[model samples]
Target: MSSEVWFTVLVLLVGVERLAELVVSKRNAAWSFERGGVETGLGHFPAMVVLHTGLLVGALAEVWLLRPEPPSVLAWSMLALVVASQALRWWCIATLGPRWNTRVIVVPGLAPVAAGPYRWLSHPNYVAVVVEGVALPLVGGAWFTAIVFTLLNAALLRVRIRVENQALAGLAA
Candidate 1:
């Protein structure tokens, strides 16, 4: 009935979606490994997991603790961004297919995919990540979580993108 309750429901839904992604990612990772896929960037994987989990937890914590009542207009706009980010994220997954595991695993001798959202952006999923990092929390008026997640995610993405580029380069070679 309340906006906070709705926000909690939304966050729980997102968490469920993330679990579904993990299921797909695990299956895809297995597919890649079977195909001689080489995984890089293991080092940051733990940090990424923690930070992402923190994003959800922190949003809830901040909202319940701080109790900021974001205006309806702002909340609606941020919700739109969150939905858009999810769409883009799923687009990336579909385009990459079995190649879309969360880890940076690249199969040798395969060509780089330039289709779907990848046609325009080298890391479109990261675009979704960045947007959602900020927007999701703000939807709950969790500004602190939004700012902290954005900053931390930026640092993590810097390492992630570099590792991914190198892995992709191996495919090219």
Candidate 2:
């Protein structure tokens, strides 16, 4: 298969995975609400969705429009990074379990998780996101998409983490 074809398949799988995340997020959100969870970062959520969707669209556009030459070594390396980030992303999800909604809703009376990937980094999922944001596009030689998404994502995460911290502080109080 051509590199473009491979990229298309990868992006499609990512879309499917995201749909599955929504299903999980919805269920988790409901569970949190039942326990009096309060969500922060509501304002940033829409922008995050748009930026992520743009990752997919921008990747495809870059591949088709730019027609960047495939470098076997670099593309394969980035592909490996993408796969690694996905694994870590899922680990973050599994570790969070019923508390793993896409929204930053902190359940009262519960301490922040200190297991799995959370043991080391407070926002491991964001790390995976930033990793995949850059890696996924470059895997298909979509450098423009990778660079643009990385910049936008960095800005988004800054606000996201701050909001999450505030929500968690509420849990502490």
Model 2 per-residue lDDT at 69: 77
Provide the lDDT at 108 for model 2.
89
Q: Residue by residue across 4-54, what tens digits does model 1's lDDT show? A: 889999999999999999999999999999999899999999999999999
- Structural similarity to truth (TM-score) of each candidate: 0.99, 0.97
Q: What's model 1's lDDT at 59?
A: 98
Which numbered prediction scores highest in lDDT against the true structure?
1
